[model samples]
Target: MILKKIIEMKKVLVINSSARTLRSHSRKLTEVFVNHWKTTHNNSHITFRDLGTENVPHINENWIAAAFKPETERTGEEKEALKISDIYISELHQADIIVLGTPMYNWSIPSVLKAYIDQVVRVNQTWKLNPENLKNPYIGLLENKTLFVLLSRGAEGYGKGEYNEHMNFQSDYLKTVFNIMGVHNIHVVAIDGTSFDPEILKQTIQNSHQNVKSLIEKELA
Candidate 1:
């Protein structure tokens, strides 16, 4: 019932995961996409989280133990972990649309984004294992949401060929991880070759913007 009611409000959250500042190409491209998405989804309000500069701390052994402990046995550390979990869960619960500015680093997503994921993807908050079903491992908690990831890569030819195909753990991993958290529909706009020719970079940005506009129209329709 709550899910049905909350579906009425469409909130979009844009997460900037690159450590770089305004000079970051990935952030610039994602901004363009977000602007276009705003034109179409006029009713949606955007919230931005800069995870690169404000990084989430990694979960340690104590945090892990606290997560598994019964509520009654939880110490002050567990309570703190729960507080952190609540903050992340609240953000996720409030948003209907999620957009991420992810730059490919060493063939994978930036470390900051990965850390943020670790914070948000809690066992009970995002998903739970269905013990009744032996084959089905998880039951998703959140639903009716869309995620758009704008990926920036240094080199071109990552699409189907080029030595970088196997190196694309970024998009594939995001798809798998977010899927586990119950986000079924995901759109990726991979802008490659930021280090390429200047003219090509400008053209790529323009083309990606057009692609995002088309995607927004289709999704909103």
Candidate 2:
């Protein structure tokens, strides 16, 4: 009999960006994903980064100078400005999978999540720039990575083909951002209208778990 090797994800980076620590639906859904993932891939390691508390600072002039400068020529002060960004990019590069815990704020992702995206998506680091190639200008270096997003919405009808589809920017924005970084495999699990009623919230939780399970099975298959 021939034995088949079971491919499993090794390194996972979980970014929890909910400002509200307690009673955050996004965080709760992310926990479900992690636990379920653990059952299938027992050896998989997850690095949890809670942006609610450990929020990365926005980029400034010093950071830009360091990022544009040749790595070997960067001064001490310039390097210091890009310190956290380097760490973030390193983690992103190392992870086989990335899970994001985000709540829909004003029809889009939370500001903290946006900030995290801004810090990691760099010029020469995550991607290569060639203005000459007008057809395919920006080139991405990172590849063969997957991203899972657990989103919570206060109101319903946000997904495509839904009533308020035009207003749905949470997943769309993330897709644009990650695609630019070369990670094209992206999945989103949303719990919508959690604030509507207790029954709705309960149903959304159950449905999200089902969605996540189906996603896992499909991906790992």
* RMSD vs true structure, all candidates: 3.4, 1.9
Question: Candidate 1: how many backbone clashes?
Answer: 0
The TM-score of candidate 1 is: 0.89
Give Cα-based local distance difference scores for all models: 0.81, 0.86
- Model 1 agreement with the true structure over 102-214: per-residue lDDT tens digits: 89998898888887888888887798888988887877787988998888998886766767788788888988888888999999888888887989988998888777778
- List ranges where model 2 is wrong by over 4 Å: 1-6
Clashing pairs in 2: none
Cα deviation at 51, candidate 1, in Å, is 0.3
Global local distance difference test of model 2: 0.86
Residue-level lDDT for 82 in candidate 2: 92
